[model samples]
Target chain A: MAAKKRKKSTAAENEIINLTNVCKAYSTGAPALKDVNLRINRGEFVFIVGDSGSGKSTLIKLLLRELTITSGYINVMGYDLSKIKHRKIPKFRRNLGVVFQDFRLLKDRNVYENVAFAQRIIQKSNKEIKRNVPSILSVVGLAGKYKAKPRQLSGGEQQRVALARALVNQPTVLLADEPTGNLDPKNSWEIMKLLEQINENGTTVIVVTHNREIVNAMQKRVVTLKKGVIISDEEKGGYIDED
Target chain B: MRISSFFYTLKQGFRNLFRNKWFTLASIATISACLFLFGLFYAIVTNFAHIVKTAQEGVAVSVFFDDGLEESRMQEIGELILKRPEVSDVRFVSAEEAWESFKAEYLGDYADGFTENPLADSAHYEVYLNDVSMQSALVTYLESLDGVRMVNRSEIVATTLTGVNALIAYVSVGIIIILFAVSVFLISNTVMIGISVRKEEINIMKYIGATDFFVRSPFVIEGILIGLIGASIPLGVIYGMYNVVMDYVTTRFTMLSTLLSFLTVDEVFRVLIPVSLGIGVGIGFLGSVATVRRHLRV
Candidate 1:
């Protein structure tokens, strides 16, 4: 008989997320994720590695409450995602930072205002904005580019600004969806390193990527999805299967 | 949610209003022209009503007694007409006094050639009416009396005035409705254009957790500003036009001066300024709703 896998208890260190048999289906028949489960301990740097259309992006969207799971349980920051009210979505979002592949920065605003916008939504004090914005910009290597427009900056610089905005709120978890998808190889590595630095400071980092080079290089706990099923989840993983 | 945040929307609206200056001015011009026509029609209707009242006051019905009636019968008929509550006052004019007054006025031209006074020896009871509408009823009752030969009133003039009044009212109300519709359309469209142009910015505000009220308040306030500016132009024009019209009517139509007291400048201003503000505020509210509904999808 197969050994019974006991559910890991998260009540010890206050787990940030716990998912069990999470399944999502867009249509009546086909499933996006089939009988999948995930557990993320607090302050963990985890990478969701999969090929294109392997449901890695779907997992991030479900975690962020941007999309709903068809059937199964998802708990994020100790709140049930399925039971979250519509009005409470903003409050929930304020607690988590989401980075888009497309870099969803407001084109009309400058670098300073773009980062300041995140703090504005959370209703932070002027003194806090005055204090945190410069520090966050400096961390993202954009210290002196406060007045620069998004279009005026390089693609890499623009992504840094996006990261800075995500970091300014000091969220519980930072979800970066293909954070380096548009960057050059050098810029991509630089951004991954920045994410590593952010994770060291006590924020749970979830990076979704198909980049084999960066995935293998980071050597963090890798959860690999193959055809909507987690075929391999290891303590430490590599880019190619070591079969 | 806070007062400071509401100010932010207002500032955004004003900024947009200035940015889209041509569209704003076009809407204001449309609103001013419509309001001006409304004010002009209002002033005309008011003056027309004054004319009607003057005409009604001047045209009195005279109840004439028969020549052969006794003085006691004539006096009894006079007393009967006077007893009706609708009758304001009754004055008895004897036939001798009537002829004497006629001779004094027209004798120089033709009275010397007449052998005897052609005027009948009849009692003329000049009846004042408290209600103008009761003139026909009073005439019918007087004609049925024992000594009254005829109750002559200006029926032609009354009928004509009634027709003119109906025409004035129909035209005034029609014009007012048309102007109101056009003005409201202009205001709503102005706001619609404004919302469409800033739709992206508005969407970001929604995504970033701005409340519906915070996103909406600025457009409403902007509508109000547009309304106020639009209304001011017509208000000044209306006030100035009233003065010019008043002077013209008083100087030329001298007969009207004694019977009809024209509206004072202050009275015109009092009624018009409120109407202007009301239009401004009402349209502003409607325009704001139009804008917010279109742009602030959240």
Candidate 2:
């Protein structure tokens, strides 16, 4: 019995994110998410696919603690989001890296400064920043472009810079929300490959995207949301046709 | 709060000030204008009060003894007058000295006609008071004492000086309060604009797990720098202006100096410098804190 209990605890430890029957309702509108049950294990790469106005964005926001769950429980990397204090939110967020659709790079700063920003926020030592930022930039295939500004870079290079920034802090989970929304097909594939490489190196990657081609081609776990409800979740699944 | 982060926040704060140069200039100008008016008022009121104090010190109450009073009894009256808390000093004049002074003033050059002393009963005690407003009370107390025949005081001068002092105090307090409020409002608005301009940057910082202190420190620093510069400029300006005005008043109106003395620039700045800097920094800090609390929820 003791051995079984220990195994159960280990399983719980491996589940990095757990959401049970989560529901979110905004003021003066229908519920954004309804009775959602999702569990993302450690080092898992999952894609959240949905049409516009679906609950995919809502789920991502909920996980980021940007929006409060209306009803249900959310536990991310050992923190109960519902019970977390506002002051602790920043500390909690440090454990997760986030990339936005617009590739939110600091336009005024150079690529190195932009990536170093995250490290600075965490108060990393200057020596650590000097070491880690270049290493991550190199990983994202932008080592030579450290001094380049966001305006001087192509869309792909800018997204790469944003990716380098997100990974520079070595967060446990990388949450990419439509990361390739504005990129061309070749650039999108490049970003997807980088996300894949990041996942293979043992970081959990959750991608929320509407690109059907990439979604179908990658053949990863796909969770589809329709009208604020999870209609389908499949392993080795492609984008389900919305009829 | 590592030393590295501390330096970074300081650097960011200075960078932010330069980033929003126009807004920073506006804030500094607002603070400078407010402090300049404050310093000007302060100099004027302090000088006015100093003049009143000098005049009050000179306006003595005359106390006369009853006729034929014993020498010991007169001495006792002088000691009693000296014991009063309101009395700063007491001097007893002999009848002969009083007669000499009266004759010297009124009978100058024609004095040989009146060899007999007409002012024999004019021996009196001159009681100087610490505050002019307390003159009436001291006079009343002096009148109640034995061996005192009369107590004479300048009632109109005392009342006028006391009224002017009271008016200066009230006006100073009212104006300082109004100016403080105006300065804080102007600084808060400037900080609000800075926040709006950096709204996107702040949001990104928040997402990147920047603590509230980390995010807010730069703006607070910006406000402090603006206040510091604002306060410093006025001190220099006021210093120059005060000297110019003092020189102009003393040289231009030579007769006024004999009656009323102006404070030296050093003396005025000894009080004004710290007070102005404190207000400037305080307004900046309070303005930034209030703006951040209301607008930068992160």
Candidate 3:
């Protein structure tokens, strides 16, 4: 029994996301991220906190390989992003899931279809999509609400649908940008709890937000950015810079 | 790449094309209008070329000889002229035969007044050419012959027919090109709007790791469907309309029908069907590619 109880150590040491001396500057403006360095191990739950213009979005975009970097190396899932050709981007992205501030669910589709959309994109069989979508929906606490549309769901439940969509692929990294930005306090805490649950299941989850209460209560690893610079990286940290 | 994904994108493209019915109809209308003009230009150009060809085919050149030229020498010159590949036939006119015919035509009742066939130097040849453009060259060649004095071909008819044929070809090609550009430009903008309408959906698809082909192919397919419908409408309309005009012209305007012939509807459609469809699909495929290339960053 003890031998059967496995350890995640083997996969955890892979360094799922690494950014060394990274720089990104837009043509119309100054540098968005300046010589930023970060390392995220597999199965780690981390929060990326920053004020506006603090490069949170740019970092997410870079990880998505949506924006071309000015300098430095980024390796995700052992793929050197700077050298990875554009043709390989789609395959690379499958290992990383992303959720936006808005729910971004297909307005025409129901919760079940939305969740299954990710699998459909990866060309999963209909039987697999049918079997997996409901199970994933139950994991997100939407077990019987598969037929419910986005407009029918509350903001928190809608975010849960989006989260279900992102997690259906069982990705290595789940990136959430302001996941609870539109939810109230109760809904925000609910989303935080769901994210915590997802992280506990061995998926490395990164949440970027300006929310203070959830950050303070979560007591997770927090990396704070100020003007595109990493000001603090703390394990078991809180909301603000108390130093 | 898989069958399920193919069906998925196919459905998406169909739904997207018809999501806003008015918008799709407007795009089709614009495409059909352009294709209609293309069809008309094709009909007019082909028929005009045929008419020009027929008119030129009827023209023959008359080569006259000098007075007191030996008949045997003129026959040798005629044989030499006949050896030219361009000359279809050369009918030698003996001086006596010319006098007899001329008297029969002009001196009808007073035929006996010309006591001695007064026509000399009438031993020439009526030269029929396979192609009218060879007339001037043949005439120049005939003038340099030993016994031939003058080569008489109505330069006005030949030059005008050639000039009009070339001008029509240039003008028709120019119009077709302009219409093609206009259709591509208009369809591209319309397709750009369609892409923008579904921009959020595309972003989500990308986030879910849809390849460039997967994301882009639907729009391209959508463009093709639009083009097919657009082309098909004008095809039916123009086919029926051309037949009606052909029937009316053949029945009522016998003079114009005899002189300037129009292609039968079947004949016109033989070329029009494929060409119009090609233009339609070409516009759609190119428009979608251009819009997606410019707008969809990934």
User: What are the chain A TM-scores of the candidates, in order?
Assistant: 0.93, 0.97, 0.92
**What is the C-alpha lDDT profile of model 2 across A63-105, one tens digit per residue?**
9988889899999998999999989989999989999999888
- Chain B alone: TM-score in each candidate? 0.72, 0.90, 0.77
RMSD per candidate (Å) reads 6.6, 2.3, 4.7
Off by over 4 Å in 2: A1-7, B114-116, B294-297
lDDT winner:
2
Candidate 1 vs candidate 3: the lDDT winner is 3
Per-residue lDDT of B21-103 in model 1, one digit per residue for the tens?
Answer: 87678767766877777777777677777667666666677888776878888888878988997788888887777787888
**Fnat of candidate 2:** 0.74
As a whole number from 0 to 100, the lDDT of residue A152 in candidate 1 is 96
Candidates sorted by lDDT, descending order?
2, 3, 1
Candidate 2 - CAPRI tier?
medium
lDDT of 2 by residue, B1-298 (tens): 9899899889988987777678788888888998998998899889988888888889889999899999999998888889888889998888899988887888787877876788889999888888888888888888899988998888999898899889888988898899778766766677677667777887888888988888889878977888899999999999999989888888999999888977899999999999999988987887677656654454
Candidate 1 backbone collisions, by pair: none
Residue lDDT tens for model 3, B1-298: 7888889889877976866577678778988999898887788788888788778767778778887887788789888989999888789887899898998898888898667767776767888777777778888898898877888889998888879878987898789789868876777667767667667877887878988788788888887898899999999998888888888888999998987856677888998999888978888787667756654565
Candidate 2 Cα RMSD (Å): 2.3
Ranking by TM-score: 2, 3, 1
Q: Which ten residues in a row have the lowest lDDT in candidate 3 chain A?
A: A3-12
